[model samples]
Target: MVNQAKAHIAIPMGDPAGIGPEITVKSLAKAEIYDVCKPVVVGHTEVMKKALAVTHTNLEINEISEPEEGKYEHGTIDMINLDNLNIDHLEWGVVQAQCGRAAFQYIKKSVELALEGKVAAIATTPINKESLKAGEVPYIGHTEMLEDLTNSRDPLTMFEVRNLRIFFLTRHVSLKDAISQMTKERVFEYIGRCEEALKRLGVENPLIAVAGLNPHSGENGLFGREEVDEIKPGIEMAVEKGYRAVGPVPADSVFYQALQGKYDAVLSLYHDQGHIAAKMTDFERTISITNGLPFLRTSVDHGTAFDIAGKNIASSVSMEECIKLAAKYAPNFRS
Candidate 1:
């Protein structure tokens, strides 16, 4: 009720062989979702039909050629059907190359709509990596594929769990390789980027906390030298440049402190460190927001649960959260 305008969010039906379709159906079933955004699924009609049958959701699918035709009303699911998926071959709880290809196609369509300004933002579902590999998709995951499609360079990944926000220095790289890439320059660069990203999300004069790479931040060089050699200087450099930055805060306590409102956000040095902290705090609510893209993009943090695809047990909390975030931040995307 605070804001009456509803942003249009594009939902891509990820690998039909997975839980994407089901979750999308379940999420769209919520009347609360229609309150803030007009969501149109960029997927196949047959796939969504099958999902509606499985989930027993009462909403009717209204396929539109574009977002402009959407009714954007409760009890009606407006979709941009690609008609790419053949429902006959889809087997839930399994990976299929066709499903992977279909999923990629859905994302491609979503990106196209985003680029054309047909939608305000995109709230994505889980796509199977094994399926992507089997389908011979060039990019490994959504982030990389999005980066390539938008021609955006190194899009920053930010996680929002409640009030706490986290940014990774590196993701999907080997632990050793990630460590090697951590230098004063890279850390400093990430700090500045994080500041810019926060501002885009409507935060002004944000405070950033950079996590240490070692135990107790190297205990003044006893535990590891990376903190002393690289991290400390990075914070100092950001501060010198007039950025509101702090820490080499210990990985063990930094996330907790940030969650407690001591800091606006934390800059995790590697993948697992931040992943563990975020997932531990709240797994289902930890949504990933890709900042620096041409348009706003949000995703469910979890992957496609192939093990429990069609039983209708997958929690739609994350999917709902993803769309909510897209609606919340869509106004900020320069794209």
Candidate 2:
């Protein structure tokens, strides 16, 4: 029976060629995971079995057609069996069209389950973009696929590690593009959204600190004018409108300050700015929570480590944290 108090989180095994299945198995091996939520793998049954052998894990795979059918207990992994992989042709760490297609199918099924409210949230594994291309899937990454699937416009990405939370202003773009996109209106817009996003995570009256574009927050226009010109003005607008926003705080210290509990979250100006901070603090525990979706979604910050695909040495700490974070926020975020 599905536990009424526990959220149902769907985990889409990443690229069949990568460590997604392996990590999924390793993460679920812990009994503590069952204590928090009911997690069901929304991927291939055969791939999971292969992962079992790779991890040398002893657990029963309970195939279920729906989330409610899951046992949601320790020593058992309940799965929604897609039965899609051709186990004979499966090779670890290689980009294959079949693996890409299977990966996409898993994500699609996961989205369906979440949209139907059968699952409270989704904790996704990594997917290979090269394999996705080879499979003729048009989407470049998880965010793009999720935005389209959920009919969500510009999904918000938040990185949470320990007590620190961060939101990106721009990602997957060159440094030049990121700078140009940081207009006052854009910054102001994101601050408001960031505040709302934090509120969804159950943060009360969040105080958001906007990271500076230049050193020392431009040092009163000495280092760079982005802070004086674009960033500060944007923050002022948000403050005027009753949002508890501040800075163009010096990038070097803003994150540290947030970690120290001075602010509820930091709005990072670019991808590397926030990623570096989160990963550097504790790489394996930095989980990416995708806000602004109909249902909550959390993912591991790392990618499909193709080189370590079948290697049992791959760590499952990030995967476990991803599922736990999804469970943690599911109650507050879900409809």
Q: Judge candidate 1 at residue 37 and give its lDDT.
A: 91
TM-scores of all predicted structures: 0.97, 0.98
Q: In angstroms, how far off is 32's CA in candidate 2?
A: 0.4
Look at candidate 1 and give me any clashing residue pairs: none
Residue 126 in model 1: shift from native, Å?
Answer: 0.6
Clashing pairs in 2: none
| lDDT of each residue in 1-335, candidate 2, tens digit only | 22369999999999998999999999999998999999989888888998999999999999999999889889999999888878899999999999999999999999998888898999999999999999999899899999999999999999999999999999999999999999999999999999999989899999999999887888989988888889899999999999999898888999999999999999999999999999998999999988888889999988899998888989999999999999898889655
List residue ranges in candidate 1 displaced over 4 A: 1-4
Query: Residue 269's C-alpha lDDT in candidate 1?
Result: 93
Reference-based lDDT, residue 182, model 2: 95
- Model 2 scores what on Cα lDDT? 0.92
- The root-mean-square deviation over C-alpha atoms between each candidate and the true structure, in angstroms, is 2.0, 1.2
